[model samples]
Target: MPVITVKLAKGRTVEQKQQFVEVVTNEAVKKLNVKEEWVTVIFDEYERENWASSGELHSLKFGEGFGMKGIEK
Candidate 1:
């Protein structure tokens, strides 16, 4: 069994996550020759404040400006 773990900043709809899982699973199945059922896609959502880059918080950097609205909601 192949286990895939994905860590992304929180704030995506269920549909989006589902799409990601499907695409990732498909790719794993095709490229890694893993069974679709055996492919595991795990998503770990985190608050914008909890995820940071370049020593700056995501919410503070992009939430206020940068068209990142609705990402925290």
Candidate 2:
């Protein structure tokens, strides 16, 4: 069995998460040679304040409502 963990700042919609899971699971099933039922996908969501990069907190760097929308290009 393959256990995949995805960590990201919170605020992604259910649809987005579902889409991500479907794609990731399919990839895992093919690349890892694991059955769909045996593949496990987990999400570890965190607040913007708790997540930091470049020595700056996302909340301060991106500001409010950053979440998934903030990282979009």
Off by over 4 Å in 2: 67-73
- Candidate 2 residues 1-73, lDDT tens each? 7888999877789999999999999998888888999988899988888988999988887776645566664
Clashing pairs in 2: none
lDDT of 1 at 68: 53
Lowest summed lDDT across 10 adjacent residues in model 1 is found at 64-73
TM-score of the candidate numbered 1? 0.78
Residues 1-73, model 1: lDDT tens digits: 7988888776678998899889989999999998899998787777777777899897776773322574556
Which candidate gets the maximum lDDT versus the true structure?
A: 2
Q: Worst ten-residue run, lDDT, model 2?
A: 64-73
Clashing pairs for predicted structure model 1, backbone only: none
Instruction: Give the residue spans of candidate 1 off by over 4 A.
Output: 64-73
Clashes of 2: 0
Clashes of 1: 0
